[model samples]
Target chain A: MEKKIRVLVAKPGLDGHDRGAKIVARALRDAGMEVIYTGLHQTAEMVVETAIQEDVDVVGLSLLSGAHMTLFVDVARLIKKKGLDDVLIIGGGIIPEEDISKLHKEGIAGVFGPGTPCEDIIKFIKENVKR
Target chain B: MKDIAKKVLSGDSRAIARLITLAENNDPSANDSMKDIHPHTGKAHVIGITGVMGSGKSTLIYELTRLYRKQGKTVGIIAIDPTSPFSGGALLGDRVRMMELTMDEGVFIRSMGTRGMLGGLASAVYDVVEILDASGKDVVIVETVGVGQAEVDIIKIADTTLVIIVPGLGDSIQTLKAGVMEIADIYVVNKADRAGVEQTVAEVESLVDITCSEKERKTPILSTIAKHGEGVKELIIEIENHEKYLKKTKEFETKRRLRYEAELIEIIRKRLMNFIFDEEQFKDKVELLIDQISKKQIDPHSAAEEILSKILK
Candidate 1:
């Protein structure tokens, strides 16, 4: 049987805004991948733990709280720290253009800013999955 | 693969999680590791929780896990959601209700999609339960995809099966007609704060009276506001009491024996079917027979009999 790609769509930080997370999750599902959405108010530790437990090929973090620089980096770094280097990390929501490269340095493979199409995210995951 | 079983026996979280994935994907290599870990299983109490959508099954499991954790019991949770037939994908949102348990080292939570399996469960659930059991969890909770009256397969896997109901969905005459209601070892009327708790409890009580034989244990029904954790302690006590009953009556061993029998039969069935269908030559021959049947030249039964004779020969 072909392996099904599993993605964790997590909302990190105190932000109650999860519409983007849900939208991305649904789009990923429609595109043929299992998506585990961890709803709003998730910590970095929570997201990384969820990623590990779910054995996801991708960890897509969404935060509209403007704490992406801290929250997304923390989650990416923690996932790496837990020896999950193969997990493809991605982030979205209110990210400035300058922080994109910085996030890349922190191991976030992709960053989708506002208005980025969901197809791009889906395609990126399908292309980048490891094992 | 040998080392994977070693790591799983040592309760390595990542190893346990990855092994479960390999099993779910039906990788043939997982069978070796499963054989290695087989003796380490049968220790964890497998609890199955099922209910209709919005009946607070997740919330009740959360509370139950919390109480179990208080007593220092390790837990493994598998929350199943439906896989979409159209896209072959699923949105598993059970983690939304279980995020807090992730931080606990003693708790392992995994979300699963049914992935075209019927009976309100993922196809790999039996293997997942054994994996968790070998990982040293004292308790394993299998929460089925939200179901109506027909998803009664949980009884075959769970040592104890909980059927969660809530007040005000409909009266007993509407929802309690068959299959699922008869399968419960325990019934929980969750969301007891709702308006129809009394009637709901009464309905289940009457049904239990009508269905339970005089020689059998009467299934207990309890009411709970699971969100607020009301009446949960009593619920756990009742579960323990039922466990005691099962052991005392030797039904525990009988249930386990029956489960293993069913599991062995299912494994052989799958392996046999896979072996037969996976050969291209055989499949092509079968397709030819199917074409003949479709053309009304050969009957389906005759074609099957010819195939069976060839296989036997």
Candidate 2:
């Protein structure tokens, strides 16, 4: 059987804003991927733990709390520290454009800023997922 | 693959998690890993928790897991949710409720999507349970989506099956009908703090009285406000008692044998389906047969016989 791509859509930090996370999760599901959405108030450690436990191919963190650099990097760092180098980490939800490149350097493969198409995120995952 | 199995046998959490995913996705490597890990299994008690939605199955699991942890026992939880048939995707929100357990070193919790499997379980659940067992968990819990009738497949996989019910649900008694009611090794009346607790318990007690034979062990009905940890300690003790009863009566061995029999059949069935459909010539032949059947040129049974004969030949 062909393996379905699995993604973990997480909201890291204290931001109660989960609309973007849910939307992206639904969109990914509609595009034929298995998405596990860890509801709001997830710590960076929690996201990484869930990613490892779920064995997801992608980890998409949605944070509107403006702690993107700290929270996203925290998740990325933990993912690497835990030897999950193959997991494609992505970020979305209210991240400033200036931090996108920095987020990439911190191991986020893709950053879906507001107004970016969900299709783009889906397409990117399909093209970039490691098996 | 051997290394992965070795890690799993050593209770390496990451390896256990990865292998479970492999099993869930039916990855080819999972077969070898499971084979290697199987010898170390059957040590953990498998518990199946099933109930209607809002029965607080997740909360109960969280509370139960905490209790087990307090006793210095490790736990593994597999929470199953429905996958959308249209997209083959699942939200798997059970983890949201049980997320606090994530930080615990002794507890490993995995969320599973039913993936269109009937009986309110993922097809890979049996294997996942084995993996957790081999990884040294003292208790392994399989929580199914709130299912209606005909979701009793959990009984085949669990050593102890817990059917949870909550008070004031109006149709709480309806869940006690035939297939669903008969599978419960233990019946839990959760949300005991709610109104009509006594009424709910009495209804279940009466149903149990009518359904079970006198020769059979009397199924116990226990109540709990799982969210507040009320009566959970007693629930766990009852779980232990049931486990002991199973062992004492040798039902444990019988159940294990039946589980293996079912598992072997499922494995063979999946392998045969994959083998038959994966061959291009056979697939094309089957497609032709499908067209023929659609056109009323051949019956499906006859077409199946024709294919079987070809395979046999």
lDDT per residue as tens, model 2, B1-313: 4999999988888899889988877789788989998888999999999988879999999999999999999999999988888988777788888888888889888888888788888888889999999999999999999887678888889999999988876664575667877789999999998899999998888887877757468889999998899999999999999999999998999999989987887778777887778878699999999999999999999999999998888
Give the TM-score (0 to 1) of chain B in model 2. Answer: 0.94
Q: What is the C-alpha lDDT of each candidate?
A: 0.89, 0.88
On lDDT, the candidate that comes out on top is 1
Q: Clashing pairs in model 2? A: none
TM-score of chain B of each: 0.93, 0.94
Model 1, B48-132: lDDT tens digits are: 9999999999999999999999999999999999999999999998878877798999999999999777889888888899999
In candidate 1 the C-alpha lDDT for residue B120 amounts to 91
Looking at candidate 2 chain B, the ten consecutive residues that score lowest on lDDT are B169-178
Please give the distance, in angstroms, between residue B277's alpha carbon in candidate 1 and its true position after superposition.
Answer: 4.4
Model 2, position B11, has a per-residue lDDT of: 86
- Specify the highest-DockQ model's number: 1
For candidate 2, report its TM-score: 0.96
